[model samples]
Target: MKNAPTATNSQSTKNNQLEQSQYNTESLTDLSTAAQRARVLHYLQNHRALTTLEARHLLNVMHPAARVMELRDHGYKIITNWRQDSDSAGRLHRVAEYVLMAGGDA
Candidate 1:
């Protein structure tokens, strides 16, 4: 499932194409937080718009609070959007969903 290059001039974009072409997504959803972060961006060069918990669980990251900040310092727009875990139950919210900022794109 490769898309024609999006007209970018960065190796990161190429790397994303390479990774997406070579990964077994069946096992991807189960990676550690840091690993997940690395993997997500690795496969897409998208490094922002991540959720706090998603960043934590998927990447196996211990200090996302700091890491996200650092990444922001470098130029990333992180967003926090929540989804309900269970519908019409009592009231519990699933962690927020994340997407990479366009800037990180190559």
Candidate 2:
């Protein structure tokens, strides 16, 4: 008879994912701290002024605070602003947005 797949197989597969939060911490911090700055002279080049979730998904860094700190320390001026919601004040956990400061180098 053929052997059936086991739960252990599923567990092992999850453990092997490099992009997941656990395995990514150290590796991401290394990569994150390395790509600390880049040229963004135009709208298209901006990193979407990415939201925290987008950062986690795209950058492999779960903690947006850590990534923001690393970027700022490298001389990129991060300007924050409050974007008002249309419906209600309690609609979202975060209302703040960021843009690189004026006169910033590419």
Identify the runs in model 2 with alpha carbons over 4 angstroms from their true place.
1-32, 35-45, 82-91
lDDT for model 2, please: 0.42
TM-score of each model, paired residue for residue: 0.39, 0.43
Worst 10 residues of 1 by lDDT: 67-76
Per-candidate local distance difference test: 0.47, 0.42
Give stretches of model 1 more than 4 Å off.
Answer: 1-49, 85-91
Error of 2 at 103 (Å): 2.3
Q: Give the best candidate by lDDT.
A: 1
What's the CA error at residue 55 for candidate 1, in Å? Answer: 2.4
**What CA root-mean-square deviation does each model show from the true structure?**
9.2, 15.4
